[model samples]
Target: MSNEDQYGGGVGSGYGEVGGTGQTRTRLPDAPSDPYGTPRRAPRASRGLVTVVGVVVLLIAAIAFANQSSDSPRTPADQTPPAATSTSATGTRPVDGKNGAIPKGFAHDEQGAQSAAANYAVALVSADILKPQMRRQIVRQVFVADKVSELEARLDQAYGKTFLDQAGLDANGNAAQGLTYISRTVPVGTKAAKNSESTTTVDVWCTGVFGTAGVGSTNPVSNDWFTMTLTLRWAENDWKVESFAQKDGPAPVHTDRTASTAEEIAKAATEFGGFTYAR
Candidate 1:
């Protein structure tokens, strides 16, 4: 079955355009205009324009809400000097059940490293890095010397012909007309599974939507769960992803939102861009 069939469609939202009933009318003027046309009257604004404006407003409001809801910028409470009960020196910690696995960047010293791992994982699986040339560049920049060649070869094979075909793309990985290819990992949380002065083992558990959403598309957007275990060697002031692996879900309960039409999903995917995660 396709991703849509398995996950019930689209990423956070499902497939299918939302439909609503609206009245249409033809207005008749009292009299015909002269040759000059009495200075052509301005047409009334379209319902579509009104809808677009409303959507923009809502999006702004939503973003504002999210920002306000974020934790304060001051030093995190966990960063305060540890109490007698505290077992770890670095107070920064991951919340239980936030992500499926342990968090990253617990020690105050390793926050940068943890951020690097999270960002690297985001880059690794992003649709942007799927292109062979780009993937190579990313691997070279982010991976350690020992693993670059092996990872490059493996990723090339993994994103090979069969994978493209399954994703409804050509060997080059471009989406067919009217289709949007989606492959992005959003870090749900990060934690330090193990740590030391020189090396830190961080786990970044992510939930993402991947696949294609389009009319008559074979691969539709769907949800996926994966944990990325990263071993970092404090290198050049950043925590680079020394190695990583993926294991499927501890998925959450589903919501009752209506699925959107394939067309809508495709449009949204195209219109919106993904983000670069940070710790």
Candidate 2:
């Protein structure tokens, strides 16, 4: 925490030997001596030297121990823990199948809630929602059992025959001649503001292409961005949409690229497939 040289000879006789003779003679004014003649004071310097050497060895050992500790790998207790990266990719795959055309059966977690919200956003804005037949199917597929009746009535009034006629669709929701009506949404991202075992609230940012894409089309294809917020419930062992609403975006500034021809736009919409989004 934080070694010694010995003097070879002991203090011998304080008397000097008479030269060339085997006689020991005591010189006058001789060095001090005890009755026992112990050499106590002479060894005092050598003991002090040994004490200093031992202290120096201890100091060196302490320094070496500190250096070793600093160079060694740190244990888990020595480091700060990482934070949860919620906005990052979750690595969980999205739901694979759809109930007819609408997405169904999401996971019972935050990611699942987000997936359900995003797919619901796409379904609600689709052209199919304008037709009575397809709209009924969409309501049944996307909304929960408790919400279906009320939502069906509200949606029916919202997309009534008058609105369909104004948009160049017949009562059966068929487009006018030489026109292919388009209303498709693509989700940019999803966020879960509140999540629990029974309920979840998610928001989906989306960019949608709406109107018609064909020759002599009065309502030309155009893009708009918006955000859809959905309240979801955990039921039937999966996430199901309970309620949803939309607001105008969070949209990016428009680019000045030349618009594609109606034929090209129609062809592209037909060829390009939509994605199954994950968090």
Candidate 3:
């Protein structure tokens, strides 16, 4: 690794023929390195352009990431998200028990009000309403305490001996030998017109049979349609009627089906019991 060994090849590369004692060597200006021999790098301006484009791409990606991260947080323009569970689900206690044959306790909501209205409508027009004791029981059970006395008096006055006679019933409100009294109500649907925490107004659409059935019957049982509107108050963990009123004929056109025989009507009335709604 002598300096001469390292430098000799380089020095020899500059020499011409060395035979004559007076030989002269020419070192031409190292023929300017061929500009096209080795691979050329991109021009400075083009390299700068590539760098600028890469920087712009990075900024766009960074801005997109920021927007995606903020998506879950609501802005003023965003609507409120729905709750995972409903608030109405609470304070809901179904009428699992009954007060005698009728459901007594009800939920503290619109459904409860509708149910109470429907049941009350049925009781108000039932055959039992003709019996004073049963009528009293119904008034006490269905109406608010403040309204019970007034409603009972009105009902008693309405179902007097004269009305009973016209209805094909005796003084005791009973149909005579070989006849069956039919006064049954069926609620088709109920709607809550207004509802609040303590009070609700509801409409009960009902269909009923309200005449005597059986052979030699003076009053053949027939269908009647009516709507009963009841304003109810939430009381003693149940719904009770504060006021009630009834109107006739939002009835449908009469069905084309032939009327049933008196015997069949009487049999069906006795065999099929009324239903209590669950809300």
User: For each predicted model, how many residue pairs clash, with residues at least 3 apart or on different chains?
Assistant: 10, 0, 0
TM-score order, best first, reads 2, 3, 1
lDDT for model 3 comes to 0.46
Q: What does candidate 1's lDDT look like per residue over 1-279, in tens digits?
A: 011111111101110000100000000000111000000011112333343233222222221111111111112124456455333233444222211121233233556556555665555445544456765776566665665676555445434564344345666657787777665556776666667767776656666655456776544454555444555665544444454433334467666776666677767767876654445
TM-score of each: 0.59, 0.68, 0.65
Name the regions of candidate 3 deviating beyond 4 angstroms: 1-94
lDDT of predicted model 1 = 0.40
Report residue 216 deviation for candidate 1 (angstroms). 1.0
Candidate 2 structure quality by residue, lDDT tens digits, 1-279: 000000100000110100000000000001112010000001112224443233222222221111111112212232344346856778988787778876677887888888887776666555665567886787677766776676556445434464454455688667887787665567788877677999987766766565456776545555655454556788777777664433345778777888788898888878888766677
User: Best-fitting candidate, measured by lDDT?
Assistant: 2
Window of ten residues with lowest summed lDDT in model 1: 20-29
**For model 2, how big is the CA root-mean-square deviation?**
42.5
Q: Report the error of model 2 at residue 27, Å.
A: 99
Q: Which of the numbered candidates is closest to the native, going by highest TM-score?
A: 2
Is candidate 1 or 2 superior in TM-score? 2
